[model samples]
Target: MTIRSRLLLTAAIGMAQPALAEVTLTRGSSPVPDGEALSTGDLTVQNEHLAFTIAVDSQAPWGVPRGAIVDLAPVTDGEIALDRIAFADFIPNNWSAWPNTGREVEIVTETPEKVVIRITRDFGEADIATTYTLEEGSDRIHLVTEMTNRGDVPLVDQMSGFTLWPDSGYILPVPGLAGVDSGSAEDALSDRVVAYDEDWFIALHAPYFDRVEYASKDLYATHTLAPGETRSFEGWLQVGPSGDLAPVVAAEIARGDIAAGSLAGQIASTSGPVEDSVLVVEKEGVPYIWTLTPDGSYEIDLPAGDYSVYATAAGYSDSAPQQVTVAADGSETLGFEDLKAPGLLDFAVTDSAGEPLDARITITEGQAPLVEFLGRQTFFTELDQVGGVQASIAPGDYVFTVGHGTGFLTEGEEVSVSVASDETQEVDVALELIARPYENDWYASDMHHHADQLEGTTPPEYVARSELAAGLDVIFLSDHDSTANHGALAEIAEMRGVPFIPSAEFSPSWGHFNAYPLSLGEPLEIDTSTATAAEVMAEARRLGADAIQVNHPFIPYGYLASLEAGTVPGGFAPDFDLLEMNGPDDDDAVFARAAQFWTQGQRIFLSAGSDAHDVWNDNTGSARAYVHVPGGVSADGFVANLKAGRAYVTRGPLIEPEIMFGTELRIAPDEERSLSFDLTAVNGLATASLIGPDGEISSQSFDKAPSTATAEFSITATPRTEGEDWVALRVEDTAGKTAYSDPIWINPLGEPDVLSQD
Candidate 1:
């Protein structure tokens, strides 16, 4: 029998529970029954326990075409637990166009007891049909997807699955692993993964697959399909109270008929059982971790396979790997022995003031034990610790490096010391302050940053720590499409005595914008779905945003590109306050675009940001803006100064112009004035140039120059035929670092300037 007939018969026989399933269609602000097709409204399926809302079209706030689950909430408390969820990114042709492609939705089966909605979308050579089902008295939603190869070529490396954006929290749990770091996908142990918080939990279960792949919030499985072949896969989305995973696991095991084998063992050394030991079981290069009990015993259920088992712990050396094999539904016992004792390294880092400094410490030479569960090699000194931090490492000749971020004078000081087993070594290092821009009322700010949002892996605490380690005076939180990390980031920034700005990256189909200095707890009022760029900026202003910045305007899906292509409705709106010089890599194209706007008499200022999403792999403040806030780096003062164009964008060098760019300089026609600039680079200076609307007006090249240099040139204010005339400064360091100053308006007296006309 068909699925609908089976469900209907079940309902007729009274085997189905009460008819608690409800289906609704939402268009604009009105919600109606499921059958109505009023311009592709969003569809919501809800049972007694959970509710799932799917955006039926691209006009939804999540900006995804076709059926994308945008919100999930529990019935008891109607709080959203998901930002958005979708199935995407089929490999071997790298087909990721589902979010931008149009599709059709059909209500295949609809009843009070059960409902199933089918969505179909076609690529050039492939077609996919996905069905979502909700049933009465069920806490989970079921999914079945079929992909057909329509072209003549065979599809290889075929893989696709759900991409999830939990509204908050980054704790991901898999079978045989308690807590897996979301930043890395090396430990995908099972076919199920759960993203949970304190109040709600959401899990993806694909039991047909033996292993799962997770990275940047995407969990999927791999398969292959030949030409004219069709492949079908089944999965489920389970929801539950809190973070309990027992129900999900049990259901997955029963559904998939998983015949998991058991591994039970003890970890011991020469003296006795190693109470603090952790067992690592490796199968196909994927590790399943188990923590031992107080008695040094561990038991884990694993898929039947040949495996290598070992033990590692703090203050102890790793044991040799032992190989074993198990049959299906069988049991095995394995134990490890002869773990060597460890030596301790006690280290302290201090500032020039002789006070304890919170700095990053790295083991540059010797092999450090992978004591950190995530296998991290670097360590940080705690702010609350009194004396210093201690690490138990393997006995060897190790070099320890200590320093702060790029803002500090020294990169780091390395000291080599020989250590013996079961011995303690003490080391201390002092860091000197190189340049204190804050003393001169200039604050370094990376205006764009992210935490554990979509495609981001670092948690809020780590985000704060990374930015602080970068020695930034101002911290800005601008995670994509959400402000959930603002409170946590603010608290950490307060504890660290740094200024914090609450912001969000308003992401839409056209491009992305960073709206900053928003009030805490203010609802994200701007509609990110159908709002045009002009409307988005207007909404940000209406929501009391201090500044709205166009982010990465020249890259793919960037605002400038959209405008140039005329893809954005109401194209070329000059409502934005700042334009971004994104990341550390210099983009000459972006500079040329900004200069073009400046020549067109637009006063859009330039700012810099690293756009770091994963702090574990990327630097936070690699490219930053130094804003001139005379009083301090308060949110209000910083935004005000940034809007006034009192900021310079830099990767490493620092530029101080005699008359800061963005300031109007009044001069008579045919009058000449001397322009001076002070340049400083951690690396030696290479060249400095004075730029104008026509071209480079004056320039100086330096060889073997000190870290600091001065450049002075004379500029004559000639009457412009049209538009406005402006002068800017650009400097490059020997290390290929670059800095650019905002243009200084050389306005002829009795003539209207760009800002004056505006």
Candidate 2:
């Protein structure tokens, strides 16, 4: 049957009465093979409306070892729509049985009408068996997990369930919430959670689950299990087309049999029937959300209980709660009175050039009538529309702050305004650019940034928006082990007139490396499963990477850590192009290590990045690389300059030395040269030091000097006893932010250096 027809049939089944359909289960190789990633004992299950593949043995990167739903798509499309869905860790016990564990799969039941496949894993003291079942005529896959304690100690406060990865740009629907992004719905209202994108949706109906938490790419639920006894938790997975979720909801309602009563209500405001409003019904402190029809009328099935009902809309006040009691199989009708009209706040933000500037807007005093989710407190201008935007907010006195990211001077840009009901207020904000590194042919880029990879909470569009707002000249996308957001970021970069570099953080068991300027449409060729650091770098180079970066080299899982301990597999390969100064905390350590390499006659340059994942909560470009792209900021130009070591790493301060770092100067012994430094900091400069292999050569204290400062130093070229001598600048601001410049190679003539040794 065609996928279109199957969708139609699924919709019919959802709307009509429940009927039985045949289900088939097959065990063998994966129907959709991903190389040699899956075990030979994979399972494929399908009904009239749904289909899925369970990886009995997963060997792919980041794959769950066994019993993970690796591939899920509509029976019609047959395309992979999900990454994977696997069991999460058991709480309190703090144990996860999947991913690097042994498991046994058994066919517990085989019948034409019903089929059940159970996967069992033993965790020494506890045994868990997760079963997948599909019955005739059912459009959902039912999953039940039973955990039993086998050891002498009793397991207490145990909770375990599955985690779902729906990729990026999926909306999550729960009781009391609609149109919430999957990452923003950390806490939902009901047991049924539906994540839908423009094409398809996957729903988790867990009537017995106690709570669920959502990250950017995945979400997991937990159910209470008792100790010393066997406990089973049940859930249903449903998939369908996007638009309507009726089919899944209907199946859940019918299976659970909890819809014993009905509540009908009408929501009306002073302006008449409220449109685009939400009806919230709370029973026993649990809130259920219902999307109202265009006429502001809603009818919902409920269990016998007393509920507090209210209504809320974007541009209106929430209706007063009305309490009503419902009997078994009974019906009740309730009406809501007036909902206050919202006031409008229109803002116009401009840059120093008097052009419309895309800025970040925040409400300091009063709250906006909009729903508050993760990172929703701040709004960006020109996100959906060009120029200024208007917001509907509650009528009150408010302090609205408008500004760009750190590079702009918006210190006193807060405006106070009183909003009246049904009134419009206008506010204007003008911001001045403070740090102008671009004018000096320097372009700033955050080397390590993520969007919707693993636990990342920011989407691609927001990633672009946030970085642009942070005044970054070049945008880089380096999601861990995935280039899924590369194309999207590239397109957005084109539209925003910014240079973009496509990169991915090759996450291996050993460490993580970022390979940049990767070609689009090319599959990631590097596999770190058993490859050494040197092999990974070779593969990255073979895959057409212009530069390979060692990320957070001094951290626990960093490559430098293993190299330092003399435990790096295949020993240390100094073939990497760049080494990261890594955010704020690792600057000193990384700098010290880089100095050692410099004194060893290695030319590995320095790079800085915030390693920002949740851009909404954290700032991107907090630590950035300033590269000298004198020609222009293009992907090729940036990479070329970075390869030549024409760059510096900074957290906030900007340093420009007269004799630019990365310049090779061949001088006679005892030749004197004068060097001048131009430094700028948003939060006043503290000190500037000229550093060499032996330590500080000369230093100047700024005493928290304002915005900009300068210093000059005269030094003589000294004979190198061993490796070539090099000098660099290190500056610290009063805010404790630091910047490190690439070394200025002081190659004294007739000295035994890297060249002579070679």
Worst 10 residues of 1 by lDDT: 29-38
Per-residue lDDT tens digits for candidate 1, residues 308-330, read 87876665667888887866667
Cα distance off (Å), candidate 1, residue 388: 6.1
Alpha-carbon lDDT, every model: 0.67, 0.68
What is the TM-score (0 to 1) of candidate 2?
0.68
TM-score, one value per model = 0.69, 0.68
**Any residue pairs clashing in model 1, and if so which?**
none
